[model samples]
Target: MTGAADRVYAHLGKWAPLYVWLLVVLIALGRTFYLSVNVSNSLPGKLFLVHKGAMPQLGDMAAFRHAGGGGYEAGALFLKRVVGVSGSIVTAKDAGAGFRDYFVDGRFVGRAKPVSRSGEPLKPGPDGAIPPGHYYMAADHPDSFDSRYAAVGWVAQRQIVGKAYRIF
Candidate 1:
C-alpha cells in the first residue's frame, strides 16, 4: 500500500508545480499587474506596465479610469502623469486664439486646446488650488486630452487604477 501511494504522489508532483505557477501568473496579470498598449501618443512610449497594488504619486505615471468625456468611453483606462496632487496650485494663462497654457505649482505643464481632433469644442480646465483627494493629470503633449481640459477634469482618488511605467 505504501509503494502504491508513493507512485501516485510522485506522479502528481510532476504536474502540480506547473499548475501552481500558472495560477499565480493568471492572478497577477489581472489583479496585481497588467500590461497595456498605448493607442494614443499622450506621454510617449507604446507599451505601459501597470502595478495595481501601488499608490500613485506626483510626477509618476498613473493609470486611471476615465469618467467619459471628449469621445472617450466611461471606465476606459487612461495613463497620465500626476502633475498636481492635493493642495497644489493650478493656473492658466492665455496662449492666444482660445488656447490656454496650464501650470501646476508654477511649472508649465501643457496647453489646452479649443477643440478636439474631430472638430468638437473643448473647454479649458479649472484654476486655483487643487482639492484634497483629487489630482491634476497631464503631460507635455500639446494634444493630450488630459486634465488641462474640462472634458477630463481633476482625477479623483477613487478613479486611480494603478501606477504605470512606460515600457516601450
Candidate 2:
C-alpha cells in the first residue's frame, strides 16, 4: 500500500495540469446539472426582504418568488393575498376604505379580489379591479408594500417565478 501510494503521488505531481483540467470539468458539469434541475423543478429560491422591498407587492399571487436577492439560500418566504388584477378599476373611497385606495378600470371593487380575509366580504370602495393578465396582491398588514408601492405595484403574471407550498 505504501509503494502504491508513493507511485500515485509521483504520477500526480508530474501531471498536475491533467488533474486540474479534470477538476474544472467536473465543477462545470456539476453547476450545469444544478441549474437544469432548478429551472425544471422550479426549485425553491430564497428571497431577502430588503428594507424598501420588504412588504409584499400587488399582483403577487403565490409566495415562491421573492423581491429581494439571496437566490436559493433563504429560509423565510412571505405570502400575500391577491387583491386585484390588470385593467380592473380601483376606487379611493367606499366601504372599508383604508390608507391604500385603488381604482381599477373605472369601477370601485374591493381591494381583496380572489381571496378574502377572515372569510369576510371585502370592503366596497377603496377597492381596485384587477386586469386580465395583471394581478393585485397585498399583505394583510396595511403598511406592507403590496400594490401600494409605486416601485413594485401590480406584479405581472409573466414575472411570477413559481408558487410556494410550504414555508419550511
Candidate 3:
C-alpha cells in the first residue's frame, strides 16, 4: 500500500505542470470567446466590459465595425452611443461657434466641426431624415470620429456588434 501511494504521488508530481498549463489554456480560450462576443470600452483604459447580445437600441453604447467611406481604415471596431434608431429624425445645424450641433428627435446632443483636423471639408448629415434600419451614432468627446461626418454618416444595423453595459 505504501509503495502504491508513492507511485501515485510520483505520477501526480510529474503531471502537475501539464495539468496547470491545460487549465491556463482553457481559461484563455474562455476569456477570448467571451470578449469576442462582448463589448469592451477598456481598450484605452479599463473603463467597462459588457456582454454582446441582442440588437442594439437607442441610448445603448455599442460596438461595431467601421463602415465609413474615406480615410478610415477597414476592419476597425468603434464604440459609440446610439442616439437615433430607425425613423428617428437627426439634424445638424450651425451652432455659431465654428461647430455644428447635432439633434435627434429635436434634442441637441453634441457638436461637430465642418472641417477635419487636416483642413478638408467634413460633410454633415443629410437634409432629409434618417432612413430605416440605420442608426446615428455619436460620442461625447468633441473630436470623436462618428456619424456627424460624411465619412461616417449613418451606421447600418448589420454593422453593430453588440450593446454595452458597464461592468466596472
Q: What is the TM-score of each candidate against the true structure?
A: 0.82, 0.36, 0.67
Tens digit per residue, CA lDDT, model 1, 1-168:
999999999987988999898678767687788877888888799888899867788899999999998899999999999999999999999999999998999999998878888899998989898999999999777788899888788999999989999888
In TM-score terms, candidate 3 sits at 0.67
Ranking by TM-score: 1, 3, 2
lDDT-better candidate, 1 vs 3 = 1
Q: Please list the C-alpha lDDT of all candidates, in the order they appear.
A: 0.89, 0.44, 0.71
The window of 10 residues in a row where model 2 has the poorest summed lDDT is 33-42
Please report the TM-score between candidate 1 and the true structure.
0.82
Cα RMSDs, all models:
9.4, 13.9, 9.7
Candidate 3: tens digits of C-alpha lDDT, residues 64-106 = 7787555677667777788888888887787885788888899
For model 1, the superposed segments whose C-alpha errors exceed 4 Å read 1-28
What are the per-residue Cα lDDT tens digits for candidate 2 across 23-89? 7865765533211122221224333222222233444335434354222233324444555656566
Tell me the lDDT of model 3 at 147: 81
